[model samples]
Target: MTILNGLKILDFCSLLPGPLATMMFADLGAEVIHIESNRRVDLMRIMPPYDEEKESYIHQHLNRSKKSLQLNLKSEEGIEIVKKLVKDYDIIIEGFRPGVMKRLGIDYDTLREINPRLIYCAITGYGQTGPYATRPGHDNNYLSVGGVLNHSRLKDKKPVAMGIQIADIAGGTMHAAIGILAAALHREKSGEGKFIDVSMTDAMFAMNALYGTQYLGSGRPPQPEEEILNGGTFYDYYRTKDGRYFSVGSLEPQFRKLLCEALEIPELIDSTFNDSSYTQQRFKEAVTDAFCTKTFDQWLEIFNEDFHGCVEPVLTFDEACNHPQIQARNMLVDVKKSDGSTQRQIGTALKISGVEPTYQYVGAKMGAHTEEILKTYGYNQKEIEKLKANGVLI
Candidate 1:
């Protein structure tokens, strides 16, 4: 059976963090109802690289298996509708600045009075209570303030922007999902709900898992090219003869032995264990030179043949998506479009044994499910038309 078969979620999030979190819950079989706004329209709807269906590719991928209700939050009728939804929907995911929900008169304190089982999650850049709580920030700003961007860079060079939204996805999406699930579990036990205040910056700061502890204990700040896994040792990326890169993470002695043997450099195998800076530099240089002797495809073939060290070519996104492992694991799925055709999209990342993820439909247009949802909540056709005519329902 599905894990969250009967769980209901009212999603009031946009962009990445909170939307992706609710998408995960929807993947787990929860009934996710998305609250959309046509007046303020989410930018994801207009981002570049739209599909043939006119919706953005990312919007389709992140918002699959959910229902959308477009409503004007500025109207009292819309606020009353949201309060009515709170009576039955147990979870609410919001991505706004600290006091936006409170100003809307639908904060956790207000909603919990409606249903004590409500699990409200607020995803923000900073946090609900901090000096920078209400500050306008984005993923990069959060990563910088949380100390990740400082150390995740070239030794003396400027920090480059990451290819993905690490703070938005890892900090906000992942942490919000975990917090909501944990609150659901707690509510199951105690018959009470919770208010989860998720700060992307705070999550990033807490993600300084290993190096942060070292700094706290040793009183020395972590710098780029100093940590073992952060380009200090031979555990790094090497360029191939064909300009492609290979990740070399043979940190353990056994793996290092395999790597050195594969490169036909037995002399450097023992030197790999040495902690001296000169020895490490020499080892890194030799490994770099050895990797330069082969092309990207040649290295992959050689590694596949017999080499078992932690070395592999860095595949591009398309290449990784089409790889045999990813294909075998069913990472790509065919989501149903409105016209009964299917569009290939990334499937749910979760891998529960018996619970299969259902992709009902692609992301809906603005207010696509407004009348359908309102009908279920006791609003008849006349009332729904009146609300729509009065600019409450978009």
Candidate 2:
């Protein structure tokens, strides 16, 4: 059986973080029902690069293996429908700003009265009670305030905007999933559920473990390009003759010696441990010049010959998607859609023996399963039609 078989989830989340967190559970065979609204469908459903017969690529990718129920939660009948479903769901994840759920009278305190065993997870920007908790913010703003953007700069340039949503995905999505799993385990033991307050900004601070630890112990904040791992030394990216970049991470003394020997620059071995900025700059320039003399492919061949140093080429997106290692590990799979077509999507990273998780299907259309879901809640056809006529079910 699948790992999450028989588990039920009600997802009142939209956008990236909360949807992604619940999608993980759905991937593991949990029955996830997304509470959507026809009047306010998820923005991802309309994002660009849509298939001719399906929703946007973002929705198809992130909402796979989950069902959708379009119900206007603002309506009293809609809220009542959710309360009835809460009694049977094991978890509920919501991404609304603080107090929104409470305003609708469906917050954790209200839902727990219906089902004390329900695990309610709230993902907010700041938190449920912080001064900036109610303030609206996005991934970049959260990263900026959490001290991540400060150290993520070059020698003199400002912090670069990341292509990936680090604060949203890594901070909110991952931490919320972890909290839900931990709470579920706790319920298994104590026979009681708990509320989880996941703050994206607070979670992003944990990513500063190394630099934060150093500053806390020594009271000296890390400057950009002042540490070995943070572009401070020769252990950084270099441009090849083809203008492609290669990553060199020879941090250990032995690995550094190996890289220096491989480059035929044995004199630079002593400078590896030097902390002087001027010396490090000269060392980095020397390595850059050396790497530029060879094409990326040539250097890759040389590194593969005998070097055990952590030196490799920086691959492009297409290269990475079709890389031999990724293919061997089955990191990508084809997900079927309702239109009898398939899309390539990334597969689960977890690889448990005898429990292989497979992609079932892409996201369904809005309200695709509303009637089916309501039937499970004991709503007959007449009741469902009456609710629809009253502008409750979409």
Candidate 3:
């Protein structure tokens, strides 16, 4: 059985973070009912990484293993239908801005009246409370406000956007999922529901915890490209012989010695180069020269012979899929499509002993389960037809 086999989740979220969070739950076997809008499909349906036969990879990845029901929350009858479902669900996740859900009359307070045991998680860019809570912002704005951008800026260069939506995924969606899980467990013991207010900005601040701690303690500001982990030649990326790259994190003396020995650089044997100024110049040049002498394959071979934990070859998406270590860890899984085709998909990163994770369905079509959901909510055939005709359900 899946971990969340008996749990019912009402996923009233969209975009990346909230959907991905609840998708993870659905993947683990939760009965997640994705409450979409008949007025508009989720933006991901038309976004990038689309497949010719199916929807975009964003929709495929985030909506897999769940059921969808398109219902317009703007209509009175539609809100009533959602209220009925709330009575049966254990958790509800909404990613709308603050006051939007309440305006629809399906907010936590209204639902708590029907089912006090429900765990309601509200995920937003700045949270439900704060001066910027009402402001419309995206992942970029959240990261900027939460000080995450400071860590990502290049030396003397403007801060660049990250490859992934760290604020959305890491901060908002992930924390909302965790909060819901925690609230669910607590409700099991307390017989009371709870509200989880997750802010993307607040969540992103966690990325700078260690630096924040040091900054607070030493009265030193966290400068761009200067922190030990963020900067320093010992723990950074370097281009290799073929213009490909590898990363080294030989922060400790022993690991640094291993790196120097592997590259046959005796000049870096002393601690003088350990200084920030000297290390940034001499160590980077030395490492760059050594890497330039050999191809990425040759460097990989050298690292394979050594047992140090500080060195690793940087991998592209394709390379990462076929990497021996990743393959051994079962990080990638082959998913069979309905048309007798297959695609390589990422598997769950969590590895719990004695508990296997499973995904039994691909992403379904929009509003694929509208009739079924209405029936489950006690709506008869004729009543559902009326709602469908009125544009409440499609």
Best by TM-score: 1
Arrange candidates, best TM-score first.
Answer: 1, 2, 3
lDDT of 3 by residue, 1-394 (tens): 5777778999998889888898888767788999887466789877877777757776877787788889888999989888888888769998888999998999999889999998999998888997888898888898898887876676888888777888988998779888988998999899999999998888887777888788889998788777777754457788887988898888787888888888999768664334868666678778878888999988888989346758988888899888888898998766655566666678777777766777655677788888998887778999988998998885
Q: At residue 85, give the lDDT of candidate 2.
A: 90
Query: Which residue pairs collide, candidate 3?
Result: none
lDDT of each: 0.89, 0.88, 0.82
Q: Write the per-residue lDDT of candidate 1 for residues 113-176, one digit (tens) a residue.
A: 9999999999999999979989999999999999998788878898888889999999999999
Cα lDDT for residue 113, candidate 3: 93
Question: 1 or 2, which is superior by lDDT?
Answer: 1
Alpha-carbon runs more than 4 Å astray in model 3:
272-276, 305-307, 336-342
Candidate 2 lDDT (Cα, 0 to 1): 0.88
**Cα RMSD to the true fold for all candidates:** 1.1, 1.5, 1.9
Q: Which numbered prediction scores highest in lDDT against the true structure?
A: 1
What are the TM-scores, per candidate, against the unseen true structure? 0.98, 0.96, 0.94
Q: How far does residue 392 in candidate 3 sit from its true spot (Å)? A: 1.1
2 versus 3: better lDDT goes to: 2
Q: List, in order, the clash count of every candidate structure.
A: 0, 0, 0
Residue 83 of model 3: what lDDT? 84
